[model samples]
Target: MFEAVLVANRGEIAVRIIRTLRALGVRSVLAASVPDRRSLAARLADEVVLLEGRTAADTYLDVEAVVAAAKATGCEAVHPGYGLLSERPDFAAACAGAGLTFVGPSPETLTLLGDKVAARDLAIANDVPVAPGAEGTTDAELAEAARDIGFPLMLKARGGGGGLGMRVVANPEDLAAAIEAARRQTAAAFGDDRLFVERYVENAHHVEVQVLADAHGNAVHLGERDCSVQRRHQKLVEETPSPVVDPSLRDQLTSAALRLMRAAGYENAGTVEFLVGEPEEGRRPFYFLEVNPRLQVEHPVTEAVTRLDLVALQLAVAAGQPLPFAQDDVRFEGHAIEFRLNAEDPWRDFLPAAGRLTALAAPGARLDTGYEAGDAVPSEYDSLVAKLVVHGPRRRETLPRAAGLLEAASLDGLRTNLPLHRAVVADPAFAAGEATVQWLERDLPALLD
Candidate 1:
């Protein structure tokens, strides 16, 4: 095990990692921006390195500064909790070049899976199904390719994640404008303007399989998560043992996910997302979406069900340890749900709400957060302030518990989607596990009113 490590991200994830590091008897060095110097993670870590910036560009996303901080602190490895530079292949390679272990997959694997078009091709080569799509580098090329993909297709940024740089074009008349807008957004978000088009599955369920792999080629799947409850293609809620998947479908999803991991020589914690659609006249049940080559935001749900500490596992893997268990050794019990508590007002088009947290409370759930009642939520960063994870013996039992937790929450000084979450858990469609990707957008208005 590593004696010391640096957490290369901020907010709740950094706090989450630092807690795990303490449990594992590893010293944690937190890298914090100027604004985050007094944050919860910074206070909790054994040592704090103040990166020289207030914005993400010169702070968390600065690979050179992060590596330098780790080296200066004598950290043997770096754990990128998630988001920002977590999925960047160059960042991984920089760590390698700096003689520090990155607690994720190899740079080659990151590069291969980070590109959506390449990942789709990889899925196809492995016999995993993918939606029909074509990659194009220019506006004219993309526009030309859309003619063949047909109407109601999705315009996506090849290098984008977190639901940015994506648009749904219902007709040819809007293709050019959508393409330009997606390109600009993609460039601003990911520094890549490449785009692709794919046929959209309107009512598909977004399911993802979690896999843990070691450097020695041993890997195991930790079942699946139902992330269909989304807004703007970004997941809002996630749960394990999807209510819609049966034994057979679960096996298929897990097997396909494992196959992709093995083929890519993947290591550490990663997620394979898929779009699962009801069988149409001739279509298959599921199509490969993309690979998230890092610890996911919703990893707590998987940990609750599998009874495993993923951060510890990632640390072990990076330390050259083989997986302690195999596929059959893994046992999943009960159902777990995670609700992302973001500082946003759902009734007002989900506008970001940033302010001092005057009063805060999270009851009836396990809370993971980086802020307290006195912390300030800056407008510069992601709106997510905390996560509430609930576990129960079965899926049916989780809904009411989740609802109670949301209702009992007493956040103040900033508007939140607590009411929205409360509404979702009580909604019959969601309670019945029939919520699709479009359910929030299509049905939330009626529930709110």
Candidate 2:
């Protein structure tokens, strides 16, 4: 394990990392914006370095400031909890150049997987299947490049995630406008306007495999996550052992993820996403989506089912330790689901809600949160306040348990998506396995009314 480590982001994830660092006998250093200096993560760290900015863009996302804090604190490693700069290849490289472990994959690996277009090429090279879409970048050349990959394509930012900078153009006439909008949004969000084109998949169920690679070149997938409950590509709920994936499809997901990780020489934990279409007869087909190179917000659900401490593994792997067990040693039991408790209102178009968390508690489940009752949720970052993870012996048991957990939720001082979650958990369609990307928007209006 590292002697000392600096966490590169803020909020609950920072606290989560800090607890692990302390348990491993590592000194923890926290970087924070001025106002966040009084937050829980800062209080938990052995040392807190306050950046002279108020917003995440000027502080947590500032690579220079983060590295400077590490250098100042004599920290030997940096862990990007999640979000913000976790997936940035440049941040990883910067840490390496500064002689500190990045505690994640190599910058090369990040770049290869972060770009949607390049990742597709890698999947193909490793014999992994992807959606049938345009093989090249430059959505601006849509008209000239129509022969190979035709219409009903998706304009996607190569570096995009979190449901930003993506547009589906169903017709040729809307292609140019979609490309421009995607490019503009991509430039605004990630500062990378590079975009790609892929065939638009209809009514596809989103599935992902969580794979862990060690420095010793051993890679194995933990299991699969069914993230089909989404809104505009943003996952709202996630669970393991997908209802649609059978044993054969499970093998396909595991094998493909391992193959790609081996091909890229990847290390640490990562997620390989796939677009699974509704089953046709007895055959089911899946298309590859982009990979997330760091820990996911919904990792708790995986941990609940796998009985693995992913953080411990991450630290050990980054320190050059071999995995303690092989693929056979891993076991999966029960089902786990995660509900992201975001400070957003379901009424009036899911608008962001920011205020003091006067009273906060989630019932009937394991609550992983970065804030407390007294904290003020800022508008500068993601609205997620906590992750409520529930587990049971099977999906049937898990479903109602999730509903019970939401009923117990109480974020007294602030508005949250708890009501929306309650609606989802109680809906007959959701309970009967009819939840989809469009279900929320379609049903929310009437439910809210």
Candidate 3:
């Protein structure tokens, strides 16, 4: 393993990476922005390279700055945790040009998978199921494609994730406006205004497969995660060994994921997302959504069940080490759930809230956080404060424990969505694993009431 590596992001994910680096006996160098100079990640890192900016655009997203930090710090690789520039092909290329390894897929793979249209085409070519979609670069093309895709289709940006630059058009009359709006947003977000249309599946379960590949052409899937409970297409809760996915469906999903990754010559960790529609005539339909070409925010849930340190694997793969185990060697032990504790109030339209955490405590659960009792949550960047991961032998036994852990824990100073999580755990629908992608938004009032 490399002696030192640079952590190219912030928040709890940065802390998460540093912990794994320490365990693997690697020195961690953090490229921190001005606001995170005194943060938890900065404190835990073996060294800190100040990015000298406050906002994300000026700091974490600065490709040149991050790459320079790694060079100046004498680091061999850079680990971009989740968001920011984690999946940017340009970022990976810059690292490569600087003679530093990026702890993810290659730039060519990133470029191929980053574009939604390209990824969809790859899935189709690899015999993986994909939703009916068409790529369009102009308004006329999109409008024409929308007709073929039928009404109630989704207009999505060709690049980026986290629900940005996406729209649902229910009628032809609104297609023009939605196209203009999505293009503008996509241009601003991803610097690419290319758009596509896909048939939207209503009340679908958002399931994803976690696949790991090495440079030696070895690949294996840890399992599947159900992230159906979402708000505005953003996942709020995730669990491994989806309550609805049986062994047969599991095999199909994992096999499809491995096939696509191998076809694309992918390496390191990536997630293949799918939309599973309700069963009809003894058959359930699943369509490929997109591939997240980085370590996800909900990766802890997979680790909880698989007993694998994904960060270590990422580093080892980047260092040109072959995978130590094959598909048959991997094992799943139990059911695991992860709740994203965001600094947002679920009651007031889920608006982001920022303040000092005056009191914080979680007695007997795996809470991966970046703040302590006296830390302040800044208004900039993502509102996620921490991730609460809990594992149990089965889903039946996990729900009550998760609910009790939330009820017993204390987090103060800012409004949080703990109340909503508590409600979901206790709600019969969620406990029974019947919640869909739209369930959270459609039933928000009932959940928070």
Candidate 4:
């Protein structure tokens, strides 16, 4: 391993990476913004480099500043712990150009999978199923493609993820206006107005597979995650051993994900997401959704079940080491669930809540967080404060455990979705594993009442 590495992101993920670096006996240099100067990650890191900006766009998103810090620190590698610039191909390329190892996939693989349209096409070429979609650079072309794709289609940005720059249109009358709106949003969010249309699956389950690849041409998938629970196209909770997926379906999903990664020559840890349609005659068909080219926020769930340290694996892979085990050597234990505890109010349309954490208490479950009581949550960054991960010998046992943990925890000074999580855990639909992508938005209000 390298003597030292720079963490090019902040918040809980930065702290998460720092712990792994410490365990590996590597020095960690954390990049911090003005507001995060005294943040938890900064305190945990061996050294801190202020990025000299206030907003995320000027600090965490600034590639040149990050690279300069890495070089100045005499670091041999940089670990971008999700979000911010983790998925940017240019950032990965720049790190390589600066003689620093980027602890992720190659820039070529990132470029290939970062574009939503290109990823879909590659999936099709690999014989993997994909939702019917058309890519276009202009309004006229998108209009023509919309006619072919039919009504109730999704407009998506090609350059970014995280449910941004996406919209649904139910009819042709709203197509042009939707396209224009998506264009403006896409340009503003990603600096790329290129858009595409895909047939929407109204009743779908979001499932994804975690894959790890090494530079020695070896790849293996850990397992699948059921991420169907969502609000506003963003994941709220994720679990392993999907209640609906059988051994056969799991095999298919894992195989498809591996095929795609192998085709792209992908290395390091990544996630391949899929949208599974409602079962038809006891058969559920799944289509490729997208690829997250970095460690997922929900990775702890996979770790709890698989008993593997994903961050450690990432570091080893970036250091040019082969995987210590093979596909057959991997074994999964019991069920695990991860709840994203964000500084948001569930009752107020999930509005972002920011303030000093005056009082805090952690649940009995495994907790990964960046802040403790007395830490201030700034408004400019993501509102996610912690990830609550729990595991049980069986899936049924985890529900009550998670509910109990949420009930016992205390959080003050800022609104959170803890109540919402409690309601979800107690709901009959969620207990039965029947919650779909739309279940949270469509059925949550009635359940809360």
lDDT of 3 by residue, 177-265 (tens): 98888888888887888889999898799999999999998999999999999988899999998988998889999999999999999
lDDT of 4 by residue, 89-168 (tens): 99999999999999999999999999988899889889889988898878999989989999899888898988887888
Instruction: For residue 29, give model 3's deviation from the true position in Å.
Output: 0.6
Candidate 3: clashing pairs of residues: none
Which of the two candidates, 1 or 2, achieves a greater lDDT against the reference? Answer: 1
- lDDT per model vs. reference: 0.92, 0.84, 0.92, 0.92
TM-score against truth, every candidate: 0.97, 0.96, 0.99, 0.98
- Residue pairs in clash, model 1: none
Task: Give each prediction's root-mean-square deviation over alpha carbons.
Answer: 1.4, 1.6, 0.9, 1.1
Worst 10 residues of 4 by lDDT: 359-368
- Cα lDDT over the full model 3: 0.92
| Candidate 1: regions farther than 4 A off | 281-284
What lDDT does candidate 4 reach at residue 83? Answer: 90
Give lDDT tens digits, candidate 2, residues 330-432: 9999999888888887765668888889988876688888898999888877788888889999989988888887887787776787787788778887776
How many pairs of residues collide in each model? 0, 2, 0, 0
